[model samples]
Target: MSLRRLLAPLCAGTLLLTTACSEGGEVAPAPRADPPAASDPGEGAAEILADMSLEEKVGQLFVPTLTGTTPEESAEVISAYHPGGFIYFPDNLQDTEQIVALSNGLQDRAVDDSGVPMFLGIDQEQGMVSRLPVGERFPDAMAVGATRDPDAATSLASVTAAELSALGINLDYAPVADVNINADNPVIGIRSFGSDPALVSELMTAEADAFEAGGVVPVAKHFPGHGDTDVDSHTGLPVIDKTRAEWEEVDLPPFVAAVESDIDMIMIAHVFMPELDDSGEPATLSPGIVTGILREELGYDGVVSTDALNMEGVRQTHDDGEIAVMAVLAGADQLLMPPDLATAHAAVVSAVEEGRITEERLDESVLRVLRLKLRRGLFDAAPVDPGEAAEVVGSAEHKDAAQQVADSSVTLLRNEGGVLPLREGASVRVVGSGSEEIGAELEGMGFTLAASAADADVAVVGTNGARGDAEQKGLVTQAQDAGVPVVVVAQGNPYDISELPGLDGYLATYSSVDVSRAAAARVIAGEVNPSGRLPVDIPGTDLAFGDGLTY
Candidate 1:
């Protein structure tokens, strides 16, 4: 069927596109019957693309970071670059009222300048990598993984979507699909769902679906797996030495699940896998991985976004210009957080003009981006209401949901002779990184607070990654030597338990958020049962995945 014929039904009921209809509504007396045809999804996007200039088309491929909290602060960049989207950082946000104004102002500017609305994005992952400060802080991804419930993942994404949408933010760079198999992984430690590929796949897909259902675009991140690496990609490059089979077994399953579930976007990682591409290029700049593996082998034709271009992992061998051009050549539809926006934008424009990057290639990405925007109703979305935003974000119901996840995720790794569920009204002394918060929670639960371990019946010591911190480990020793029952709580990383051995009781909260801390206090006080299991194996110990104790 012709494109015009297919689009007629879509325009039949709308007065906005009068051009799509005949000069008049005059109909033939005897019209021949035709078979019903399925509408072409790309027709509307293609029509929009046909009218765009080369610069505007190229601009649609870049989602850069804003300079400040308000739209006026970023006016120069917005007017010059015409970015398709803006990623929010901590500095770019203040409170709900300001955020709504910023989002609405930016969108108005984009619409006025180029007749296109911008994609307002944020990394509101709600755990360690959260960007928004006003929402109900939920536990980390690994904490949810410990609960072994996919519903928790869905709730997290759903609540996040609602809160973000209220604040006029539409895209969420979240639901990290990396199956964290390496215990030494610095960046993706607690951000990932779990170590098991199947578990990660299940939870990640659930979150992605929930985000989409709640009218927010979800971007599955660090593709080709940022897990299984010892280096932090933000400051340095991480090289993962794994055979293709090993990569498929460990890193590929979650991405495969994401692809199969039709995720809206996938953020490419900056890790170097020599086995995938021998050219020493990171996944963000390698056609062999981005185009060959993700597009060809995996059949993901949706929007493929590169990780932050400012990161050292992708910047070691190329300048901002080269990195931007190479990412397009490598099949990334979106260039996120480019180090230098002007240089990157000019480079992509020059590449297309010089035949280094074809206009056809550029259109493929622009079309994908436009299709997503159109599909998500970005073209017709109304300005967000600031009053509504205030009522929706960080609501009481949302806080309850967060607390439930935290409560279910408090994994009791060890409770020797039931040292936990301390005797009613037992005097406790809290110490360590989060001791102040933990102590406050215990006091609220009617436990008597003691100044020192020597004066307490139990020493509730909190450790946040005590593996390298001697002071934190010493607190545990002091509690043990004082002849008080030491109940160590691993508030950050679960591996802290291995460092502080011989504890009378041990708990792994997997995060240090207020909700997680409050849940830990409840677990100790026997108000809530410990049901969370190990999401990752404790290195250098017999403790494996799926290990946890209950009251």
Candidate 2:
């Protein structure tokens, strides 16, 4: 499918507001749960645990994305397996009113049958990763790293969680713990904080605290790290060949920090680490990685979830049944987006029957999942007021916060030949694929968006995919065709700049968001002096770290 079609459900306007009473209508924030009281005996717990059928237990292991399924379909799916949790994609969300109806409906089904609330999750990492269209989009992890303010990170996460929890979402798949190592890395570039491991660790801690404070469980993800690889796991697998010391210093720190800060879950990366696991398998299914290292050595007892099983990294190598069996044997507590439920469920059953996966292991995940549910007060006699759904989406306060993040994250890479500070009356030609971002951020800036090559004094262009030799050739042609004082913006990587034809100036903000566009606009308009430096070496022999032309 086309990218737009793929993202349509995600970016669709499903979260429309209704005439429901405002959740903010003088209702005080819910009170936090006190420590379990002595008077509160462990009553009915055994019978509740005992009533679970094998299918119900197996279903608890799977959390699928809600796509191509209606509320009735969702209810049927839940009824069949009695899944312990449900994760939402943009398809599941429309507006607050619809989502509220959906969530309440789903929960009502679960309560009517099993008498337990289902865990609701979303990828609300804020900024580019946010699933909530109207919700706040904070600057990416890199921007938080750049700010060097833990409080800012905490505040951003808190606001994100408050909005998410208000919508009945209990879990946030966020706080990317990966450290940015490869500038040209397809997926985790801007998503990570920076190249520094310590900074990422600190930021992740702050995010976890903020999420928990707002009554949302934070899930740190893509462990041990996806930042060093150049390949996108969405399409294919990538390998990281780091020594033990390298991992300890780089990839492992942020995860350790997150664990220490009491983060509730971790999503394992699919990339293989040959150095750590001799089996040459992705870390998600490696017992040595997930069980031995993360659990035994590092002392993390929280939930361990796999990244989407449909991702080519894992799918290409194993069938649904093998993947499910291996993941549980490897000590993963939950499986996300497995392609086939029957096969996966059967695999777990087979493993249990064969003694490869023990009842204890199943109980381990069950207890952990139950603890989270208990903390969320799912067992408590509380009513979910459907009218409160409007409060779950973007509010005026959230949008303003998101805008601030976008504005602050803009960084300037380079401006030489004094081509910048463009003449006030000079016509400018902006040519690029990310027209959406440019229009959103720079439309109000002095320069007008040029429709053709002839009507401009300066030309701007952007590269969409990989940052290698192919991009170099394309940049050169665009610069020559425009035939003006050219300015190139590398949205992904700074690689191959030497290949692009001579230009009066070049800027690298490393992303194509409104923030990056705003930064480029300010630099071109001479409103802000260029201050951002190159974080990685360009793809040439001469360039090296700490040697690039720092603006």
Candidate 3:
């Protein structure tokens, strides 16, 4: 069947099924259909934009950070450009109660003044990138990828969307579509599902579908791809020099899958892909890439938002604000985290008034943005029940789901010399940065588990040892003070393990997620054998780790 036919019934069903669950078992089911077909939200957005002075249009283009500002200050900052949307930061979050109230208040004010509901969004990527003060975080994407289970990914997203939706958040910036190409990739390391485009595509598309099915929009981010580069976009622009053939085979396939899956939005990256577009600007601002390629060739009609403009990657390099203007002229519908809304607004408005950015292009973008909002039922939907925010934020079900993902994601990196599967109550010294309990409630669960590192037969070293050089040296000295053979685990970055001292065994989980931590814990306890192998190779290491033990 054609996608449209399959989707039409779903979209129709979604609109018809508005049954809310009444504080009981078996939550309400989804529309069982595709989301409502995309359409312009009428002349409302354009009418408003038309009435908007150049300043307002500029504001509409920006989705600014609401961190570090008072309610009044928040109002003032947004009031300046009347930004199109607002992205939540850690600062804007405190607890479920505060977040719900704040989000509702912000959206209310924007609508009352501007007559349009602002897109309230969060980067609730579950595990590591969560913004909720206390809530469920599923295993990292790598874990889901490891499972290679699209249903698991979809279920995880469904639960996440339901929780975030109850708090009044409409957009989830997640399902990092970047294939895990660079194993040592500092930022996207474990954040990615795995190294294969097909796997990442399938898992992410299912998750995106689940998000939309749950009434929250899913945004596939850091496009054309952030998976292959060695540099972090947060600090500097990383150049991907792969040829068109390689990109099509690997880097670009996942995004193509996501678009075909009908993802609501795409967040473009700021990295320079010299082979694809040698304009020396990030894909976010490159007209050739945005308009000529994404729109003309790829045929994606969804909103194209920029990665945070505050990042040095794009901010330091672009002078004429050439990238921002060019992106819209190219085909993007939204400008996210703009460096300065007013400046961007003026540039866009002046360009439009002067015909540099044709009115047709502006209309096209506004139409897409408005259509997305309408499809989300933003304007018609009632405000979330603020009182119930706490009840829903990090409910027991959510946390349990998170724990399950964590456990399932844990992989045994390596076990040499048949040292694993140790006898119970064996003498062990545990030491590592990731070994410490990152979870708050796990302390009470230690009756069956080891209460402390000294209680074990094996000495394990972990990343929690030292935060800095001074602290790191103190960690080694502390371990030596214990006078036990130790196995060290590196959680954050593998580079720090180069100087690890007084360790008999070494393991790296690459993240502090409960699954990896628990895997390390289980390895020490001898409850579960270390059968999984390392997916990424560490430089200068003689050890070759695959997906499973050799013996």
Show how many residue pairs clash in every candidate, following the order shown.
Answer: 0, 5, 32
Model 2, 456-492: lDDT tens digits are: 6777766544345575456547656766777776655
> Model 3: residues >4 Å from true position, as ranges?
1-58, 67-71, 320-323, 438-456, 464-490, 493-510, 514-516, 526-546, 549-551
Tell me the tens digit of each residue's lDDT in model 1 across 270-311. Answer: 999999999999999999999999999999999999999999
Q: What TM-score would you give candidate 3 relative to the actual structure?
A: 0.81
RMSD of each: 5.6, 8.8, 7.8
lDDT by residue for model 3 (98-184), tens: 777777777766654454567888898876787766566676676676555677688689889988888888898887988766645
Best by TM-score: 1
What lDDT score is found at residue 111 in candidate 3? Answer: 55
Q: How accurate locally is residue 269 in candidate 3, as Cα lDDT from 0 to 100?
A: 88
Reference-based TM-score of each model = 0.93, 0.82, 0.81
Angstrom error of the Cα, residue 229, model 1: value is: 0.3
lDDT measured at residue 515 in model 2 versus the true structure, 0 to 100: 55
Better of 2 and 3 by TM-score: 2
* Candidate 1 least-lDDT 10 residues: 29-38
